[model samples]
Target: MPKFAETIFQIMKKFFLSTTVLAIIACLLWATPFTAIKIGLKYTTPLQFAGLRFFLSGLIILPFIKDFRVKVKEASKRWRFVLWVALLQTTFLYGLFYTGISYVPGALGAMLIGAQPLFAAIMAHIMLRNDKMSWQKVFAILLGLSGVCIISLGRADFVFTTTIPIGVGILLLNNIVGSTGNVIVSRDAKNMPPRVLASFSMIIGGAMLLLFSIPIEHPNWTAVHPGEYYISLGWLAMVSALAITIWFGLLGREGVKVSNLNTWKFIIPIFGACLSWLVLPNENPDTISLIGMFVIACSLLLVNFLNRRAQKAQVRLSSMASH
Candidate 1:
């Protein structure tokens, strides 16, 4: 290879292996399932499908865990915390998410899900003593909300007449529920093994969703599904298993800052919206929606910039104090 090309390859290799890049990969994996979920929902009811996906995801993680039975036994002592996470994170969050996605275009659904971090920041501000809201964070939240509003307005015709508004509301609620789950895990799961917690909570949550679906959705198990349906389900389960596992590993790594790692999630909407537009037959870019996406993307960038600046200032102050 030419010297210049070799140099570029080395740089790319290092970048790809970095913790930040791994987080981005996890987010990318997460972004993929929105499309798969939409496809699977076409052939099955949302609750039943979600239940199966999560159930399978939990099972998939079991084989990777060493001394799985011991871990599960230990984790069982914290059953209440596990159950709380199960209910809020898997069951409620995804139950609402799958149902809401059914009513919106895939691109729009991706954008709404991408707004999760904005809600998360607010939740952290309110719940965590050390994570108080800064002026920059407040401004970013407003900008993020404006982007969401713009996205909703882009669907003006369907907003009132169809179920679009209801779907949007449900999705926003899903973000809040997911954010609450994050806070709970951060505060309470300090001693819990993430793998065990992830596995059992998903299994329990999945079972609950299945039980709820039987009475509520009246799913038709006898009906034959297309190959695409199974494919979508399998992919979604794998995405859930792989992405969550990677994220947990990243979080446990030494010297990895959680906030800095999480900032990579900003790319989820970018990849998700683009993928939906490219793959979903019914989804295409609208000028207004694109503008909304750009605004949201900018808000994420601004927040990330602010966070980096704050971290650098803290480092400088600590050095000065030591001197």
Candidate 2:
């Protein structure tokens, strides 16, 4: 190989192996699934599709888990906690998510879901005594909310017949439910194995969705789907499995700060929206929507910055006290 080519290859190898790069890759995987979900929903009802996707994701993770039966038994001890997480995180959240995404543009759905970290911060503040909100967090939340409002306004036609408003509202509610589930896990599931928690929650929650769909959606299970539908479903399931597994691995790595890793998630909306515009024929970029996305991105960055600063300040104070 030429010296220049060799040097570029070495750089790329190192970049691909780094934790930061892996985190970004996980975010990218997460971003792609919105477009896939939109495609899959075309062939089946929202809940039915989401159920199969998550159930498959759970099964995919099972083989990788060491001593799966033992871990499951341990998880069963906290079955209530696990069930709550399943209901809130996977079932209710994704149930609303699929329904909401069905009605909205894929870019809008991605942007709304990407705003979850802001809601998560609020949930943490409310639920954890140590995570009380500061002025910076308050400001970040307000800015994020404004961005959400802008994005909604940009998409709305102000007509009663349009489902855009309803879709946006459901997605916003989806974020709240998701944030609540995060807080519950953070506060209570400290001792549980992460993989086990994820696996069971997805499996159980997905089953609930499937059962619920029978009565509510009345889906035609016998109907055959095109190759495109199966392709979308497979991609979505793989994305969920890989993204969650990768994220959990990153969290376990030494010296990898959760806040820093989480910062990469800010790019999810940016990438997701761009991908939707690129891949989906009906979706296109608008100036207002772009502006809204930029605002939301800035808000997430501001919040993550403030959080890291606060963590550093606390570390310094603890050092001083110890000395």
Candidate 3:
């Protein structure tokens, strides 16, 4: 029995490397937003909820702003660039995201959100010379996206509606625009600290969202229970801060392609479904959703495996040349 237990432990340990483990944790954390959004929307309108979440997320990073200011001074004229980043990354990204989430189930929202990496791959290829797309990468991206389609179409509740398409389209647009922002930031390669960029961009974007929500939503504060409000905001803000920080940090990691980093985002929907099942009442996934999740996970594993093989081959070629 002891030997069997030891073998099981070793098998589990071999399955998850440190980076893969970290990525899974990050994906799980990131998956919370859809559920959180569902909870928060019980108290506030979508735009207002998004505004508050991102505003607080930005505020959480304020203690580190002194370095951001110094970086801004050196790159003074880039405030416009920063604003553009804020517009795409925060303002439109969550503006549309929150709005879209309202229309779809959390599980469906997760599937749509998982499509971001596909958009990111296309944007990265166009924007970064070094991150050119390969046939394998292209095929991997399609496989991942096909899983999203299966999830969407295979569900029994699926139906075509004007509102449903609009919601899905907005989410897709959010991914495209958000991916564009990522490529821009990567192309800049300013080596700006991720926390600082996150701080300023989120603040700017959140303010814009709040401004829009004021005229449109006029969200009533008295309607929200203080405990639930604080809890939702706290979770959303913390996850947003951490996810963005980790995402940008990974993007800046040497030899890590943005598309490669994003392919792991496929796990977000899988974890999202599991968590929603556990946390949100009436959110248990069905057979189709489970099958779709399996497809996406397999695609991610395949992409990463191919990437590692390619990287190893490149290293070998470099070593041969040096010798």
Candidate 4:
């Protein structure tokens, strides 16, 4: 029995590591959106973009499912977790985040919204005894923040101005909601299969966004920028919508913020500072940007390691006590 339990643990550990890697790649992939949003802003209002992105992303996801005709109406009825997920992650968070981008720079706005992970880390520690805060995790949080400071000090391109305070405020609200949603997901939605949870959330969220978009039809096709049109659309669909949907599913089960902290381990400040080049072609990411990214990555890795080691130790202690 002990051997079998250990084997299962080992398998789960490996699976988590792989999923963590994929999740990180997805996080980095999302870095491009900072630039894409700048381009997207050139054509559409923030509300318009938010509504369109959700609608388009949801549409893209629907065709890919194997059993599109099949419906599991009972899942949400059986589990109230889906309702909270729909309201927090898809409906409010993205709506505010996408809209906020209209008021702030995409890259900079993305960085500010990073408060989500900070909230995630703290919430995970408080909410889950298994994911207690450790010195190493503290170091990781500090390191990640330090990287952001480095970028702020060096980059003349990103100015923290007053016009966008409202935008930033909205994002902070989004961050709070997003983080709480993650905690709920981690506690309640862990039992559901990842794909099912993800698909359901997206469908619910997309419906909400569409319902809201009707009143704000400022959509003028002539306003669209040819160069950024398809690229921006693709980014919202693949990265922001689909990628985030999968991540929300993962987070609901694994402390989305904590599980996601791995990706932020490096990409936030690095991409935050450097991505101006990809997202904003005229802007340049200096050495300071790269250094900031490196520091943040180191911090997150340290924290993640501490958390994992602590979890392992707790398990061992439990086994000994049982024996």
Error of 4 at 73 (Å): 3.3
Query: RMSD (Cα, Å) of candidate 4?
Result: 5.3
Q: Order of candidates by TM-score, top first?
A: 3, 1, 2, 4
> Candidate 4 lDDT, tens digit per residue, 78-149?
446766677786888878777776677645664676555676767777777655565566666666766766
Candidate 1 backbone overlaps, count: 0
Q: How would you encode candidate 1's per-residue C-alpha lDDT over 1-323 as one tens digit per residue?
A: 99999999999999987776788789889878766776888888889999999999999888987898888888878888889999998999989987887777644675687677777777777776756677777677667656765665674443333777888899999999987787777667767677777888888899999988999999998898989999999998888887876765565555444434454676666576678689879878889878877887787688778767888998999999999
**Candidate 1 lDDT trough over 10 residues, lowest sum:** 254-263
Task: Give the per-residue lDDT digits (tens) of candidate 2, residues 137-163.
Answer: 767766765666566567554343388
Please identify model 2 stretches exceeding 4 Å from their true place.
1-23, 101-115, 144-169, 246-266, 277-297
- For model 3, the local distance difference test gives 0.78
lDDT per prediction? 0.78, 0.77, 0.78, 0.65
- What is residue 155's positional error in candidate 4, in angstroms? 2.9
- For model 3, where is the 10-residue window of minimal lDDT? 153-162
lDDT of predicted model 1:
0.78
What's the TM-score of each model vs. the native?
Answer: 0.80, 0.79, 0.84, 0.78
lDDT against true structure, model 4: 0.65
Where does model 1 exceed 4 Å of error?
A: 1-19, 102-112, 144-159, 162-169, 248-264, 277-297, 320-323
